[model samples]
Every structure is written in structure tokens, then in C-alpha cells.
Target: MLNGLTDAGSYLQGVSTLQNRTVILSLNGNYMAAGDSYYDGLAALGICYEDYQKGGAWIFENGVPTLYLSGKEYSQKYPIKDGEIYVKSELHNEDCEDTELILNGKNYSFVENGLNILIYDQDTKQVIDHAGTDIYVSFEMIREEKGE
Candidate 1:
């Protein structure tokens, strides 16, 4: 029937894109996959981290992650997913007390080790984690190096 065919087409489309789509993520206390609303927020900030080589960065301040681009401050958001303490706006900034935003008992900057950037823990000063592979960032850098 016509209804059956339509359902099959929809299912196939979902399967194809869902498996290979590249998600745009923003780093807070954890990695966040940006949805349409988040992209709108980023646009409001007037900076885009969607590209590599011109990728944005985050600086933790007062237990909050302030977003940056090209070494300048942009906007920030607080996203709470699956009970992890991610960044928040000023209204909920006080709620960060439950989260260990402090690195090694004090604030620390991200350390660059070649192409990888490491974030340290507040109490131990050990490399707690780093961002996942940002393909756009890598591609942009490669393009720049070749002067293309």
C-alpha cells in the first residue's frame, strides 16, 4: 500500500543519516552535542566554533566555563544532561557547588600536548580528560598549512 511505502522511506532516511551525521559539540564540564537551539544560542553570541583551526575554546571561571573564539570571550551556556554537572549561566552558577569544577583544588588552564588538549582534575592535577576528535578543526588546520 501507499502508506507502507511512505513508512519504509522514512525509516531508511533516518537510518542513513543517523549513522553518519557529524554532530556539533561544545565542551563544558563534559561534551555536549549541540541541537538546533544551541546553534541559535551560538549565533546570538556572534561566534561560531563549527569550523576547525578557528575552533573556539572554553575557560573555566568561578566554576563556570566561559566560551571563547579566536582568544576572545563569547557567550556560554549551562547544559545538564544525564545528571552530569555541565556549565550553566549566571542564574544557576551557584548550583555548581555539587560539581568538582576546580582542577587540582584550584583552577588550571588547558594544556596543549601536540594536537591534543588535556584538562586536569582539581584535586589531583592529573589529566582528567580531553575533547573528542573534532574533524572540522583538524581539517581547517590542514587546509591552512597547505595555504589552501
Candidate 2:
């Protein structure tokens, strides 16, 4: 029952399973995917591969693949599921007083004095303040794309 992309940081932390799938992204982004073999070597964090059709590009390194989406490398080692929750956090300034957050793929850039906030959730499409929380997202919520 996972939803959509929740928070970036939390989602990255909570990925459990890995599978082969196609990721449709903007022309300027990269995609990654991971299968059973890739997940076995990971004891803590995992790595995945991503492919981009528009660019006719496939990046593979050490049996892991990755794609740069929107100027960021989206790791395929992490599995995404529907109704899953995720969060992304960014510093507002060098002072570290203000914070910008993204949850469930949505963006929130008006948080102040917020630390380790729950920025996104795929299932609920909601972003909340996660001060001292560690959440994991299930890989069953993502749909498998064709030709992946």
C-alpha cells in the first residue's frame, strides 16, 4: 500500500528489496535498478543501476548502476513501493537555522529550526516534522515498468 515518493533521505534509508524495473524520468535525469544479485552484497547500504532511454545511456560500475535525475544521482539499489513514505531535507543556509524539506515527492521550503524532519511519504503524500525518527519504506509499492 505504498504511495508515491515521500522523502528523499528517509526513503533512501528505508529501502529494503531490489528488483529490475524501468524508471521514467525527465530527459536530464538518470535512472538506476537493482536485482537480487545486487542486494546480496550489501550488509548495510545497497547499490543499484539505472538506465536512461532518451540518452541511450547505461551507467554500470562494479555491477551497480545509477542515473543522474535532476542533477542528482538516484540510486537503484533502493527499492520503491507504492504507498511507501520518504523524506528529503536540505539546509537553508550556512547558519543551519532554516531548513527546506521534501516529502512524498512534494516540496516544503519554509521550515525553521527543524532537524531530521519527515519530509515525504509515498503512501500518504504527506510531510511531517521528524525530529527523532527512523522510518523504512517497503519495496512492494512500486510498479514494474516494461522492458526493464
Candidate 3:
């Protein structure tokens, strides 16, 4: 049985098969592949990869389609789950509608956009909230400028 983090290539292979995983790439828009420089630090853990995501999009990576950010602001909300909820999202640039963000949604849409991630376990109640690259964290954030 593969206990705690057997290796990096193994994890990537597993992620390729995961149904609910997200990469939020910024590649040339591969069928837009992508990557980030921060991941190189994983070498110390003995987990590494040959290629990495370097694009900007929240699309289905395993399939044959690409995704990109648009000029549309979005505002939606969801009640906290038992006063404890874990949400994860990846974003590179805020090309999402070049307009003034009105105060709305379960979160502050206009808040300073930065590298963010979160994960919580129901049983252990372990919370890992990260704003930047956390080797113990599994994520990659990318950005693409307009008129590139």
C-alpha cells in the first residue's frame, strides 16, 4: 500500500487519474499546457516531475480542451459548512472583467488577488491554509497578461 507520499511521479500519475482534481494552468492554451517555478523546490522531498503546468486556465486538463480567463466578474456565495469549509481555486491574472468589483459574494471579490489555497479534514480537523507556495501543499498558480 502506498503510504504517505511514496514519490512525486507517482502522485502526478495519480492526479492524472483523479476525477475532481484541478490544475488551473497558464500554458499556450495545449490542448494550453503550463507550469510554475516554485514547484522546483520539491526536489528536497524526493518528488519531482519531468514537465509541469505553465499556463493559465481552470479547464479539464485530461481531455482535449483549453480554458482562459475572461472579462467578466463573478459573484456567488455558499454558506459555511459547520463553521468550517475548505475551498480551493487557482488564478493567475484578474482578466476577469476589467471593471470595478462591487462588494459581493461569500468572499470579498475585490480583495487583493494573490496565491491562495486551503484544505481541511473533517475527522482530524487539520487545517492547512496557504497563501503562497507550500511544499507540503499541492498546488500551482499561473498568470497570463492581456494582448500577449
Candidate 4:
């Protein structure tokens, strides 16, 4: 049985089998996969990954991802799961049709921006109270044209 941690790398691991999930480790270097089971087992302990050198904690609670900044949980909204990641460049390359997002060769034509995305039913095409991220991208938010 492992006791309290004394170092960062003591609890972090780079495992190939986990794919996108952040692999954690027991104090004795046992690999722990990310999932609800681990969360349930460790939730009360606030099982956070602290970057002592950088000053922050990466948290995953109830399948919702968040960043603990300044001791507060700030949600990092992302809903894409279990699919091939399609970046903005690929969206451009595919010449994505207006109002249509093709993921895995299927059309998902509805989207609403929220902390997490809300993609609606395929047939109804109306925003449902759910979350999804078939298309994910990162870009700077600019208020005015550059070089103006």
C-alpha cells in the first residue's frame, strides 16, 4: 500500500495504452487508468494532479474535466468522446458543407456553444440538453481585424 505523495512524478505516468486518458499512478508506481471507478474511489480525497513547479491542478470529476486555478474549479469544456479527433485544418480540407459537421462519415448538423457543446438530435436537428464535440479546435479570440 502506498502512502502520501512526496513528489509529482511519483503520481504521474506516461503510458501508451491509455491513449487520451491521463494515466495516474499509485505512490508505489502502480498505473491507474482514468474512469468513473477511480473517481468514485478517490473523489473524497480530491485526487488532483498538482503541478508544483507550475502551480495548478488537473481534475477530472464525474467525467467532467476541470482545471483548479487559484483553488477554484474552472471547467474546461470539451464534449468530444470516442471518435477520431478532427481539427480545424481537417475541417477546412474536407470542405465542410455549411451547417454540417461530418464525423466518421456521418453528418452532425447541429451545434450550440456553451461551456460544453450541445449537439442536437440528427433527425430533429434541434439543440438538445446534451453535450458533444465531434469537431474540436483551438484559436485565439480577436475582437478586431489584425494589421488594421
* lDDT per model vs. reference: 0.27, 0.27, 0.26, 0.24
Residue-pair clashes per candidate, as listed? 9, 42, 16, 0
Off by over 4 Å in 4: 1-11, 14-54, 59-73, 82-148
Best by TM-score: 3
The TM-score of predicted model 1 comes to 0.24
Candidate 3 C-alpha lDDT tens digits along 1-148: 1123234334333333433222222112111112343344322222234332322222222322233333122222222324422122333454322212111122211213222222222334333121222223333322122232
Tens digits of lDDT, candidate 4, 14-113: 1111122321111100112211222322333345434322222233322333333322112222233444212111122222312223333443323221
**Would you list the rank order by TM-score, best first?**
3, 1, 2, 4
Q: What TM-score quantifies how close candidate 3 is to the native fold?
A: 0.26
Error of 2 at 22 (Å): 9.6
**Model 2 lDDT vs. the true structure?**
0.27
Candidate 2 per-residue lDDT, tens place, 68-121, comes to 322222222223345322222233344332222333353333223211222233
Error of model 2, residue 27, in angstroms:
26
Candidate 1 residue lDDT tens string, 1-148: 1112222223222222222111122333212322222233333333354632333444332223344423122333333222222221121342221111222233222212112122433333343333222222321111112221
